[model samples]
Target: MADHRAALRAVVTQRMLTDPAHDLAHLDRVWLIAQTIADQRTNQRVLLAACYLHDLINLPKDDPNRHLASQQSATESEPILAELGFAASEICNTQHAIAAHSYSANIPPESPEACILRDADRLDALGAIGIARTFAVSGALGRALYDIADPFAEDRVLDDQKFAIDHWKTKLLNLPAEMVTDGGRDLAHKRVTQMLGFLEIFSEEIGHPLPINWKSV
Candidate 1:
């Protein structure tokens, strides 16, 4: 397993896109989280492979073909899996997990491994790490921290594409409800609590304290 992990890391390091929010470190964290919440029946090997390669074909968030990235990654991983000595069944399962892990992919996770992979990956989009990632990606995309006039979108529709903070209300804060596993949900709630705390301080520091209703999960 150590050798396989090293091999996967090498492959990822060689091929990962130059996105701060989706680097090798992100993949490492996702794999770690998946292991932590995985059930006894979960296949660690498949989960590990999927976690490392799920973003194999990384696409810009605003790309019209963003929803297809996961499926493309799944296809791209086939030859790599074969080279890594994966069995036919293992390769199939691994590809399915990778293809279904994306939020935009809209593919249902049919196996426990796929569910865990999805939950773990989404978990990365919450808590302190999640906050950092949100800002990092937003900065990369040339978005503002928040709308100055109505930071909480009080007067306008939420638009994460233009404002980083709007993403919390639009998606990040809502992730707990979408978690597939009980463990993932529990962890997501804890992470969201931290995010809410950050939002309160952020609002106050900017002289635009959020509405009381916007502070909780």
Candidate 2:
């Protein structure tokens, strides 16, 4: 079991390192944060593994073939896990966790490890790292930071507008509540607060000058 787990980790690490969007450094950060939280949890191994591998398959939001790509990767992952001799249960759990990590899917994770993995994945979308990734993704899609008005909102349409800012308002800010383990919640709350503060400063800077009295000491 130990050897199989190690082999699986190697495969995930290699794949993530090669992936362009969610690269190795991103996976490493998530795993580091996951370890800090998982230390207090019962299923650290599962959570850690899921954290590193959750984004193994990167799907571009604007790609017309996005759904097909995700399904294909999920299908491929099962065979890879089977070849690695991972237990059926562990393979299923890991796959489910990965599938649920997508923003569009919105599937509820089944286990504490899954929840922790999801939170860890989303945490990468906040603060400095998140800002870089957001613009990277936006640039790739040829999107400006602020569209004149919400393009998709007119049709009561679903679009990236909500996905972009809501990362700050919803998942990033609400992470403390969504976190499954106590330690995860504690650590997440601090980052969430930092992200919120960053957003506040960002909005003020871009929108207008603050009054002299409103300036901090």
Candidate 3:
């Protein structure tokens, strides 16, 4: 069982590494956060495996078919797990967890492992790492940092963000409240506070008029 689990992890980790959107480091962060949150009542193996492999299907960052990609990834992951000698039940649970990880998909996690995986994935979107990913993804999609109109509009699609900074107001700032696990929520509170502080300071700096001596360097 242990060998099979290790082999499965290796395969998925490699896939994640090669995938641009949800890269290997994202998987590592999810596993780290999952480990911190998982308890005696939770299945660590299931949670970690799910966290690492949830985004195996490389969906376009702006694709409207987000749920379809998640479902496809979940469906494809089962065969890999079965080939790696995972039990049928374990494979099914992992598939469900993977399928439910995406927030835009809106599929609620049904098990403890799934909940932990969801929370861990969300935690990756919160603090310093979250900020980095937001910009990385935004830059990859050629989004600007701010738009004069509809800066905080929730109805605006992912492509509508003129800049990466606008994403904080659109989605990133709202993630903490949606987290599913207690540990995830705790970590999210600190990270959210950090993000809010950054935004406040940024606004103050941008709002103030530049001094005459402060020439462009």
Per-candidate TM equals: 0.98, 0.69, 0.84
Candidate 2 lDDT, 1-217, residue by residue in tens: 3665567567777665343457777877787776666645436555555665666566676666565543354555777767766678877777776676655566777776767676677677755777677767666666665423432123243345434543344334555676666776676767666665665676565664323322221
Flag regions of model 3 displaced more than 4 Å: 1-6, 17-21, 148-160, 208-217
Point out the higher-scoring one by lDDT: 2 or 3.
3
lDDT of 1 by residue, 140-211 (tens): 999999999999998899999899999999889999999999999999999999998888889889999788
**Candidate 3 lDDT, tens digit per residue, 1-217?**
3565467568877765354448877787788888898878876666766876788886776777866877788988887877766788888898899889888778989999888988888888888888777777887788876554533333455444467776675567777778888888889888887776666665565664322221111
Give the top-scoring candidate (lDDT): 1
Error of 2 at 141 (Å): 1.9
Worst 10 residues of 1 by lDDT: 208-217
Report model 1's TM-score to 2 decimal places. 0.98
Error of 1 at 124 (Å): 0.6
Q: Which parts of model 2 have CA positions greater than 4 angstroms off?
A: 1-21, 39-41, 64-72, 147-177, 207-217
